[model samples]
Target: MLRRQARERREFLYRKSLEDKRNAIQDKKDKLKRALDENKIIPTELRKDALYLQSQLEFDDKGAEGVTTYIDDEYKWVGVDDPKIMVTTSHDPSSKLKQFAKEMKLMFPNSQRLNRGNHEMKALIAACRANDVTDFIVLHEHRGQPDGMIISHLPYGPTAYFNLSNVVMRHDIPEVGTMSEAYPHLIFHNFSSRLGGRVKTILKSLFPVPKEDSKRVVTFANQDDFVSFRHHVYKKPDRKTVELTEVGPRFELKLYEIKLGTLDQADSADTEWRLHPYMNTAKKRKFL
Candidate 1:
């Protein structure tokens, strides 16, 4: 009887010892898992298998079908990687458009003024091709107002024509200062879909984007050389031709160019050029 009791006691202790060891190992595993999770020590690529970084993305599919926004996808206009532009104005010597073209060339990084304006479009395009000019911006003036513009990208074209309003000039600025020859960084604002994404396509002719990673210092203030462009377009639906009454929706484009530097900076007095005040107020203010 004594032997039997001793054997039973020994068996019970052996089972208890095994259970304790298993419990210790499981606790260790739990602690290790918690540590790995907290430290983010896992490689991101490896974590992708577990869909770790997926929370940073957005999915915008399944939108309503019939809602029409006149906007388009990102606009694309491919031109020479190294842009070479020929700038010109109307043939009229007295045309203010010529002066506008001169100042505009300064805004572009690498561009030149044509020796003379060519009235013939086909001949002008041929001349540009011969000169290896990738694109051109032609300023058109009517009477005295600088009212029209034409931009053509070489080879294949999404050539664009525009009618400008509230056009302002350097001379118009009451207190304009001499500008450094720094190539101005350009800012394009408020050109929506109805503009056929022409702003970007047109700008690409001036500032071509690189194929690889592009790092740019677009963060300069008005003191630094930078240019801003604003454009607005209004289109009305066709009414009965006899009635001649117009009906449609309209939109606004707001563009402002301020000297790039902070107000306290001595060099920040950029030529004060802006759209006419009447152009802005007259649209909203009911006629007196």
Candidate 2:
């Protein structure tokens, strides 16, 4: 009985320590945020310490908005003219992932799932350069769910990394490919953070980049509590039969992070993007 009590006391102490550590971290972040909101400059000695917090704050403030790095500086329409996009999963040859890529290709006929030679980001970029491929999406999956994605734009770019949740496959939606769609509009909701930056990357791949600076906003929203994205198709009032066909974002993205280079710098980019590891569901939560 005494030993059990001692163990319980130790566990309580450990939990208390963890809670205190978390609270201290939160307090520091709150202080930094307040200072930023008030436009107060930190002392030089403290600036180094606040740099990380300031960076995170700045990241949140813009959330991939106004980032033009991905825009083609030379051709301006590398992927837009023909819109050749390549989709490939991680090196692990998961048949389901390959099929998912195929469905993605069917959804956008211009896109193709590379059967061979799509291992590293650098190799993918080289292949794209050779094949005139302008955009590419690399999906990192965990237990069949595409938890993360690396979106790259060609000919000088700003690649964007994204987090995906509640992913619904094309096959899951009944008669998805068989049903017809008439250019359904994209509905973005509550997309915060570098999501705007990533949105440009996605749009450039699917369509053409906007030529002029026009004040337009497409916020990402869908999740109940957090930011999300959804695709809605409404039947025209004049139509008797429901179009019987619809389309969605294919998958929702959180635009968790952004970077300046392409697959050429994938290693460092992965680190910056916090690349999700591929593993079973339980293992993923424990390690990845």
Candidate 3:
């Protein structure tokens, strides 16, 4: 099993490298095609190979517009199978954090909550892989307040790290009835950019496909890089009226980093993306 896994990883990396080259060529082809269509000068770098790329463009078709990347491989089975998620807290978590982890488990259908105990990260990830868990989430706390979240896609990954704030668990809300366990319809607002789209895919894969008539809804709204999470259930009282009720466990997530490997390989994984808050344009920039 170990040898097979290592060989598969190597094959995936090799394919990813080839995909990167294809994407670069596709980008150049796009630029050349645009310049020609607009009757403008071809870029200096592409002038030498303009004819070759132009000839290659003739072979392109609508079906081949976007080349598949490693991201496609990562989520190839997204809609086909329900994601199996494992939710756990940091080692020796506080009571509040434990409650938060439970709520998270309830949030994602087909998810299981596990006790952290004294298990090492490596061993925990191994167990999850053995069980065929699709995603593993670790909630962290600071002084008894949940403040961090790490979501790692299993087998192979593109782990996302987020700063959690304003967490309101179900236990904290009075009269918040039992949460719904049905697959939820997702609403993602303001995730327009490429990076935003990437983040959206990561978040969306957590939940399975919902039925058209499912009343449960989960919203991830982004404003100035902070994603506010809200859960709701709706009903139609009359022909023209709709009633909505807010479910418990609301929170905000700010992405800090995305690594291209599982949690256990954090030290060796390549950093896919990371927030730079100290940059001069940090205040003016908006990421998702």
Task: Return the TM-score for each candidate structure.
Answer: 0.44, 0.54, 0.95
RMSD of each: 28.7, 15.6, 1.6
Off by over 4 Å in 1: 1-80, 117-119, 191-198, 208-288
Give stretches of model 3 more than 4 Å off: 65-67
- How well is each residue in 42-134 modelled by candidate 2, as lDDT tens digits? 645546679776666554543556433213242346444766778877777476677767666654436778764446666667768678777
lDDT of 3 by residue, 1-288 (tens): 779877887888788889889889999999999999999999999999999999999999988755678999998889999999999998899888888888888899999999999999999998999999999999999999999999999888989999999988876777676678778999999999888999999999999999999989999999988999999888899989988778879999999899988999999988989887575366546768
The lDDT leader among the candidates is 3
* Candidate 2 wrongly placed segments (more than 4 Å): 1-75, 78-80, 116-120, 174-184, 190-198, 208-250, 268-288
* Predicted structure 3: clash tally: 0
Tens-digit lDDT string for candidate 1 (154-225): 532334444555666666644444433443333444334422243454454565543332222121111111
Among residues 3 or more apart in sequence or in different chains, the pairs in candidate 3 whose N, CA or C atoms overlap within 3 Å are: none
